[model samples]
Target: MTVTRTLALLLALIAAAAFAPIGPARAQSEGPLRIEITEGVIEPMPFAIAPFIAADSSAEDYTGRITRVIANDLASTGLFREIGRDAHIGRVTSLDAPIQYADWRAINAQALIAGRASVSGGRITLGFRLFDVVSGQQMGQGLEFAGDVDDWRRMAHKIADEVYSRITGEEGYFDTRIVFVAETGPAENRTKRIAIMDQDGANLSYLTDGSALVFAPRFSPTGRRILFTSYDSGFPRIVLLDITTMRRQIIGEQEGTMTFAPRFSPDGDTVVYSLSVGGTTDLYSLDLTNGQRRQLTNAPSIATAPSFSPDGRRIVFESDRSGSSQLYIMPAGGGEAERISFGQGRYGTPVWSPRGDLIAFTKQHEGRFHIGVMRVDGSEERLLTASFLDEGPTWAPNGRVIMFTRQNAGGDPALYSVDISGRNLRRVPTETAASDPAWSPSLP
Candidate 1:
């Protein structure tokens, strides 16, 4: 993809999940209250979260904050409607107390959550349980998370994950990080820096100074190294940065050329990117282990924005070979390609979902921009967001949600997320304007 319009369009399409939201329900009083994610009408399951009991007197603030975090995480999914505290007929006051399931059921709570928190020795130990209020039974085994005091938010997310997983049967994505280009200044002279933060926009830290322009910062599958394009050397080049050490190395060096749009392979040992020469660009892969180079695409038509499937058997990329920009798929080893997108709009920036099912893309048609997803074979295309500019869709680790950048004319861009079902559209609370968000896999 080129930067003027078509290439620029490639950087923007940060959506695309082929998800029909899971529907939760209380089937029978004693039957397992589980949600099947594949096919159902989404009427968020009603759940009540009691303020976590402070096992220690000093744990009061943490108890409240942790419960709120858990509730917020569940609410954000649009899968659970948190019952307000004031609406509850009973309260949880002791960590070992029995839950009044009848009271919760009387208030129409299908699920109930109770937790306990203790602060000691500069560490926080949190334990939580999820119950099927209607059935008056524990849904799953209770979980306990212990960490340093400052890691309270993550602990809460872990609890939420347990509850979500117990109910939905899908893995949770709450304990994840999103790395993106943090923007500042005006639309004309914007300074972009690579920043990392929690999935909810907490714990933000800049990975790069804004002295240079950066784009498409993707996390390695291991989340230890990052691949991105930067203009630090006065020309666009692909660079790799270590997350813990903050050291960077420019890869695939050439005498004089442009190398951009970098992404880690499934193995995280190779990077696939676009190299520009003369008037055309092609895809190339650089193996980090042996410094081996391989040309993946040699199309005279511009080919960029290549993303590898989860199994590394296939690749999805954006190309302009068909007289216009469209999505194309090829073998991960590189070979003849097949055009995938046959829509009215121009498609670019195709990223494969982690689940290896859908490819999310950015499209421009009829003057407006959108972030959308299509099946692996390019069927079931669904646009999740429409805006003046929406691009760069990265999948949550679970692939249940997609986050992309949304920009209005003359305004800085902000990160936004929408469910795969095209519901629960919300802004990621980034501290600054952000774009090209690449969601990190869950932390260890």
Candidate 2:
């Protein structure tokens, strides 16, 4: 997405998500969203992950390194804690050696993971298993991966997914990838374009020519195509581009209306956006399957920045019908939108967390912008960053970290990340100035 429109939509979204309420009932307290889930209280899992044993002399090169990467990925999630390397008791270089459950229990680790890496010719194969220390039994069947040596990280992520799914009974996020805007250049004339990369910031590839401004690029659920808004015609319109071939097609045939803030439904068969007609903006949804269009909101006030919930049964967007912008959730097919945010600021760019538990947004209050999260019902507002301008938050596939753009007045803009808890803030360095970050779904 173009930097200006991206920031503008975020500005509108922040106004929609954090504005002051107009009525005495407190719009947010109308009632919790119907899709609310009572996620159980989470406790860190103590896991002992050791280097994969090499099955033969040929496999020695990547034995320890590959296993270490797997362990590190799991530990970094914050849900799993790794037992220190120095605390390891009995080493199992081969999966066949029975695990010493007592030793892992001594370290207070509930789960023990052991694996072996083998290379036959040019292909690499990995096998791993998770053990329940308390039960003294294998938690699930062993997992195996086969790929080229260059795909070792993918294999590791798959192994982590298996373990995560087995323990939590929830779908694993490790298999996902993120598609974001890779930016470089000055603040005013930034060389921004669409880019795809792994969730860990690796294997980055440019998807646009950098000749025009692209903003808010979102991946289809299948990751085969990307839906974004571009200003190739000097006015923004919703466009869909095939990520692989870079071919694109604009959705609407309107002559003068400008479209912005586009997103794909969970099914990836529909797109929702705001179209400005004669200076009045409203919400509309287009069926990608048939090119049919339907209006969702017709208020003179703007109803922009639409996002679909995970189940695709509802949508959360920002509207200014109350004189100022605030978050609103409504049925995906179209209905009354219940206001969700009642804070003393403007809320904008409301993006639902992939986990379906929280909504991340941009907030502006008292001359400063902030990136924050709140329940779908607009409860428990937690701001993650505050600065001259912090906007455009995209969640990591895992939902534990958020990436966005931060601009300091006339200074260069850059991409930064912070844990959802507002900790572990760090900047993601690019070859040049980067903004308008759009994280992709997990890689195929």
The candidate that achieves the highest TM-score relative to the unseen native structure:
1
Worst window of 10 by summed lDDT in candidate 1: 13-22
The reply for model 2, stretches above 4 Å from the true place, is 1-46, 56-58, 83-89, 101-111, 132-137, 148-150, 167-169, 355-357, 396-401, 408-433, 442-444
Candidate 1 stretches with Cα past 4 Å from truth are 1-31, 38-40
lDDT string for model 2 (31-97, tens) is: 2111111234445678888778888787788877777767766665566788877898867756777
lDDT of 2 at 52: 81
TM-score of 2: 0.80
Model 2 deviation from native, Cα RMSD in Å: 12.3
lDDT of 1: 0.84
Tens-place lDDT per residue, model 1, 30-143, is 347777665346789999998898988778879888888899999988889999999999887764667788899989999999988888877777777678888787665555
* Cα shift from native, residue 28, model 2 (Å): 38
- Cα deviation of 123 in candidate 2 (Å)? 3.2
